[model samples]
Target: MAKDNTTAGIIVRTYMVGALFLLVFYGVIFYNLTLYTEDRNSEKRLQLLSEYYSEKYDLADFDTIQIDPLLTIYGDYSNLPDTLSAQFSESWVGATTFHIDNDEEYSVLAQRIASASGNQTIYFVEAIGSVELDQVDIILFQSMLTGAGIFLFLIAAAYITRSARKIGGPISSLSNQLEASESDFSPINLSGHLPDETKQMLSSVNAYRARIKRALHREQLFTRYISHELRTPLTVIKGSLSVLRKSGNDKTLKHVGLMSTSVAEMEELTQTFLLLAREKLDRDVVAVDEQLVDRLLENFSGLIQRNEVHVTRVLSAPFSLDAHPQLFSAVINNLLKNAINCSLGGKVSIFLSPERIDVIDNGVGLGEKPRGYEGFGIGLKIVNDICDKYGWMFKLEPNPSRGCTATVLLK
Candidate 1:
């Protein structure tokens, strides 16, 4: 079952539990108070009857005297009813109420007198039909009280709901404002009627947004500066290499060719970095084909040769992806470079389909190599970031027999 985590739910539940406890508490107290009151009233009436009868009749004449219909007098303790006799057996001082054989309630009192005729015991018993009526009245009173408590509980529950909504309103508004302004880091605006605590929270959120905006501005400036500074050096090197190629001694020409390749790779890296630094990507449709793959492989030819890794490609069909060309190329380049570096003398296989690309390498599997091994860390981070921006799924797992498999789900 799902939990009720909302403010209104918590408030209502708390109020209901408290109200229920109060109702039980009040009911017990009411019932006990009614019973105690009735017991005291019954005892008082028995005491008054005992006093009135003791004055009206003499102890010697107690047996022969006419008894009142509401009262029963026992001149001897042995002549008393079994229920009343059992109560008087313990003491001859107090009054108590009990039921007779006919189930009629009686208030009984026992008195012992020291007289000239010898010691005598007398019992005065009175039937109290009012006790049954009192019981009915108590039931009715409790029922009324319970009904009133239930009504109050419902009112309290409604009040709690309104209170919860009132308490949660500002927070909900703030949340909606944040969601609406997701692409724009503007300060939130809310009604002035908010609580002091909520106002403080709003201030904190706006301050945090300002800090993030400033940090992003700094990052943008830094990336642009780096891109501009590096391009000048790369342009100068390309020009120098071209001049060296024109002069052409065979060894110098070969060296110029290598320098030209390195320069080209450097230019591509600069473009890739600039594209990745942007807050938003250019929505260009770039074709992922054998030509693009071959160009990326050429940039990593030195690594492939040094590692002695044989590379192969299996193209099910040509495909296109919605992404910036430089970003896409960077992703493919990094994944392939990492595979070659890890495979060292083994095979690196690339399987390309419309749906996904799988780069499987028969080399030391993940975790088998030490931390910070070549082709890990920064390379994988770049691939992951690009994949996330493009809304693609990327996974890396150890291969069954030997190396590791990195799969990028394009769809």
Candidate 2:
């Protein structure tokens, strides 16, 4: 971008322009003040010296009088211009000032003072060409300094602009990536290490990307799960129809009831899936169905037997969770798995109340667990995320009696 167009670039350009204006104004004022003031002072000093000489010395003794190097006195002043001589001859003033032009490089200022004797006219001449030459040198020096200042400013401005672009590059790229279609969504990977603020912004962007990815994954999984769940009931209904065809009229009612039960189960599962798959949690109000826990335990029966772990249940009857069943099941599954793994042959306690579920185990506490414990595992992380999504309170802390106790308080 042009230096005068971008935000920082414009600021630098404006400052440089203002500085240049100030420099020019200062140079003009300085040059004029010094030049005119010096000229006036010099003229006054020369006039005083000429008066002293006229009062104290004869015309012949003018050569003995002290004078400035740039000044000279002439008692036999005969080479004046015709017009100037005529003017001075008629004028009755005590002194007259004149500018004399000649072939020499320097201009001369001649002040004529009438001597004590009327016949002699004394001329005081001063060369002022050196002052003009010094003025030129002063202007050149000021110009050079101003140019150097502007050059350095441009370099600094360029560096600042480049740095700003570097800092914003990652964020800009992330924004472009986010603007893509949902199907085209992908992880954002920034190339190099950036400043802390930019890094934080990139982290937030990546977090948002992860959220989108999870939501999409859930969408795909929901579709697959719905199809899979529907197939079981469909197969049951088909098998029952085959049975009805083979059996006599007495068993016809049994086959019909079987088909009806399959249909009812499919409907229930569908409703559950729909509730769990919803994007918003505003309508979530999961009532505790007694069969929900029965199904969960039945599903985990094989794992329970393999682990050879004793289970103690203190669940309140007619309980419910104020959350989607799928999400609640996930949280329970992760916590239960972690509790079982940490139990190490010890008894695992499952205490449930109207508002919360507590899984207490007598295994090594979180502090004593190895580095790769469930604290850093994907399951525990998912459990935490689910709990956070539904505004549930979850804590996996070390129990006062022994190992860790996992608690999930539903809102």
Candidate 3:
């Protein structure tokens, strides 16, 4: 269940650790190589000095004595376990011997000088008497290389840490924002060149924020719709029940009729409210079936005739909508019913297009937003809400002749 970022962190940390490991191992190898090279060079220099002494002393005394080049190796050479012997030479005078691996030994260079020699013998003088510049240079070179490697590693680690923090900064900022408040449904306003993963997360968060904002707006409208729609029916129910209790003739029959009408209106309001809520106002999607719109219109045809209203319907052949048709039906039926009430036996014409549905009435037109009345009062607000929900453009303008035009467009 690990996230991609965590997996990436694990991989990167592993690589950096490996790099550090290799750097340390490489530093060790470099130190060993430097030490070995210095030791060998020092031994070569000692042998060269031995040759210098042999040439010097042999020429001074004509003694056929000389020191062997290998025997004069010097510079911390006391640890040489292979150079022990008791033999002395003509060109060597220091016949001091030492034990190597439990065997007595003398310096081979000294053995060569013991047979014959003068004060100029190469004895003890066979070793170097001074240090050389090359040795110092190599030592300094090794130190510089090691120090530079460490410095480079430190700089690289610093860069990595800085880069990681910089990339995670916005993510941390966004996390803080999420944990801060719930009612603050603002858009995520971050400014920076974000990494891809961070950008994707922000995109999802913003999408969720937008959806929640839409839901909240719809809920607010639902509250308003509830207040507006329930008032009339409740008033009717109260008045009707009161009249039935007082009157005596066919009072029961009268009360039943009024109460039945009131109950039906209340039920319609409740069902539509629930439907609007269930949609989550996400009726903003396409794929609305034309048959649903046709069925809704058919359902309300009876109401239009009951109100003494004439209809002129002209719909495009098989055109669909990206909205809820039941909601559309509520909108049109409310408008038509309002026109019927105003026209006193008038005509309501509905024209449908691929993108919009126009309900034009040659009667009482739009008075401002026209939401206050229209009798199916919740219907108008639901219509407007659904229009907003689906991004369907709405227009209410005066008809040049008479009445008003209500145009709802799906753009």
Candidate 3 wrongly placed segments (more than 4 Å)? 1-262, 278-307, 368-378
Residue 49 miss distance in model 3 (angstroms): 76
The model with the greatest TM-score is 1
**Which pairs, if any, clash in model 1?**
none
Better structure of 2 and 3 per TM-score: 3
Name the better of 2 and 3 by lDDT: 2
Over the full model, what C-alpha lDDT does candidate 1 score relative to the true structure? 0.79
Q: Please write out the lDDT profile of model 3 over residues 195-288, one tens digit for every residue.
A: 8888889899989999998887888687667857786677777677677656745868665655655565565556566665653544443333
Compute each candidate's TM-score over C-alphas: 0.64, 0.34, 0.39
Best by lDDT: 1
Better of 1 and 2 by lDDT: 1
lDDT per model vs. reference: 0.79, 0.64, 0.60
Clashes of each: 0, 1, 14
Error of 1 at 138 (Å): 6.7
lDDT of 3 at 179: 78
Candidate structures ordered by TM-score, highest first: 1, 3, 2
Per-prediction CA RMSD (Å): 6.5, 17.4, 18.6
lDDT, model 2, position 242: 72
Measured with C-alpha atoms, the lDDT of residue 30 in candidate 3 is 79
